[model samples]
Target: MTINSAHRFEPGATVVRRDIFGDRVWTAAPRRVIEDRGDTLTLAHWPGVEGLAPTTYIDSLGMDSPAARDAARDQGFADLASGAWELGSWRWRDTTVLSRFQAGEHFSVHLFFGAGHRPLHWYINFELPFRRTALGIDTRDLLLDLLVEPDLSAHTWKDEDEYAQGRRLGIIDDALHAQVELARERALELLAERQETFPTSWLNWQPATDWPLPELPSFNGV
Candidate 1:
């Protein structure tokens, strides 16, 4: 799909970091568009959902323990009654995510924070390019990911088993697998060389209390 210039976000626009499925909604407080340089967008995360309620009690309870199953069922009903099925009440610590989508490249550098908003590690997600729809832009997360320390002193791969499982299930094709691998390698190189793939200034940033909270759009399917 052609990238629509009109659909590009502007700085200060309230946006969300959400997955294709409406189930996993993050940034409930609505991440502000700190930088919207056409091809890239930097978002400053605010307090948001800490955890999402389980969809199925059966799935949540691995072995079908009767007590656990009953508890999960009750919780599910309570969540539905309270209308908390869509968004949880858990708050997020300080965090920031820088997204880039140029040509066919799609990735995000997520920075986690500790106490006092101290810089923590970076979680890099490589994924498919975003497709903008009427509701919002949507992208699917690939199985592979990378982890880098705050100092950029070391880096490691993450979710290798999941990636391999996707390949085995024919979900991740050869081309996509190679693409993700290359993306991981590129991330390692950047970290090793101390390259600034995303703005470091956002590491210490926080959102204003008056910033609007994000609401999930109606998901009719993509």
Candidate 2:
């Protein structure tokens, strides 16, 4: 059940990702709205949530060698930065996440869950503040993230190299880079102060078992 409401989209509405570069439709992953408190919007992502992905990412998953996969993983982000990849399907497999976005905030806190719906940790996704689009929201991921322990005892910055690459490729401009730095501090402060945004009670949060998976539209065979 939702606490406060803003009615941006009804529960189970699809949210498309609008690219920061021009008006290109980069990705669209359909998610069910969990709550909408005007200030904060929550969306649920479950397994089989299909959306756009770099083809190299799909290819890496099947590689037999760990080194090869790692190399491919690195290349995938490079491909994304260069706009040299095809649009491929990416499914959220074997996990769940509740993404909470606050208006004008440069970061979104994503609560991750594992098997049996156990709260695993929080993923602080540093990105551009969402601009409402016709489909849902328009925000570009900054290629950097922070992973916080479930208990808030520890945190780590993830994908720093990729983020640096983003800077080199001009994907993240000077202004956006400064914004990310500020957002990083804000995320740490929230974690350090044990803010309500990262509620501990939600460690066991799970949706109704009967709820069906959200469907991804084909965009007329994109």
Candidate 3:
């Protein structure tokens, strides 16, 4: 793991995501760089922060119309399978407290809060390990995911159907699927061993009062 601080992102900077093909996916709202140790990058995103989505839904909408947004909410999986998408917009409404990625790991761990901002669960997102970029990070979403209880007492796989669909659509090739499967096992070990992503102190951590809701300046950055 690289242990350089100079190569890390500054606090309160926005980041963007790109597919393996280098196509824009979505740019996050301003996220607080909780820690950027080169080996492990931790970030935080609070509610009300607005981000740009690079999705071209199947409704023939460019993501500006309410109807398009509604359609995306309804049949997003189908649209993703089509592979004919474009730029759109979305706002953070969930309790995404902390997002941490280990260097060269094929997955990331995110802590989320529930109603009233209470500690909820840890979300393990399976994707390409992030490569640092000038604007932020470069990576794309894999269809598979895992959800673990806050105490790591229970866990479940998510988006199985979506993952299968991705395979059928040739979105996740054999090479990528191999990596995803390995990541799944590693994430499961963390759960079965009751190993939380971060120390217990992080479970109770709260957002700073001064952290403003971040806005996205652009979504095309690498």
Candidate 4:
């Protein structure tokens, strides 16, 4: 699940990601480049990450110090409470409102994350906020809303072959099929929330203008 994009980076900014060891590593390019410098090594030591010792500050660059995190938290909290954030029927990242060039849409600053502007094929307004908030630092709420927490006893497949396998394995009966379907229905509710149509939204969008567009076959009282 590795993804690389031509990401915009700020000079002194750093980001951390969880590694295989369950330890946070400085994944930003500038930070890594500084780490390889000999003098920087002597200035700070990489304390082997383990239980109870989750974070190690970069004393050399005065980065990720407790003070720095606190400052960031303060700024974030201030932004969250600011009156500049507008309340609307649906929340959207401010950039998305502007970028989409919406004709009748509304927005609030609170709803927008700079990284969450990609459009999806489905229309679910409730889920739209979730998608827009997903790439931010705190995404638990969005993830939970989008995920269909599976019922362990429910049948996972509708096909006879799959049902038979479950029966043979002494798993739940095919009656569990309804439970799976119920889960699926909830998932669809999430999808219908965003009301945009594919390849047709205002953002860099163009309608299919080819004349004599294919007409649908009539159902003719079938």
RMSD, one per candidate, in order: 7.2, 3.6, 4.2, 24.5
Q: Write the residue-wise lDDT of candidate 4 on 111-211 in tens digits.
A: 11123344222211111111111111100111011211111111221234433443444332355444434544654543345333212323342222331
- Of the candidates numbered 2 and 4, which has the greater lDDT value? 2
lDDT of 1 by residue, 96-189 (tens): 3444444356567777766666777888887776655444455667767888777677778887866776676555779978878787777777
Ranking by lDDT: 2, 3, 1, 4
Clashing pairs in 3: 56-85, 56-86
TM-score result, candidate 3: 0.81
Candidate 4 error regions (>4 Å):
1-70, 78-194, 197-199, 206-222
* Residue-pair clashes per candidate: 1, 0, 2, 8
Candidate 3 Cα errors over 4 Å, as ranges: 1-6, 17-22, 26-29, 54-83, 219-222
Best by TM-score: 2
User: How many Å off is the CA of 148 in candidate 4?
Assistant: 16
TM-score of each: 0.69, 0.88, 0.81, 0.17
List, residue by residue over 1-222, the lDDT tens digit for candidate 2: 223233377765666554444344555677778876666778888897777766787888789999999899778667666766666777879889988888888998998999988888899998888776556676888889999888889999999988988888788889989999999888888888889979876787787787887776656324
Give me the runs in candidate 1 sitting further than 4 Å from their true place.
1-3, 16-18, 21-30, 49-103
Give the C-alpha lDDT of model 3: 0.70
Better of 1 and 4 by lDDT: 1
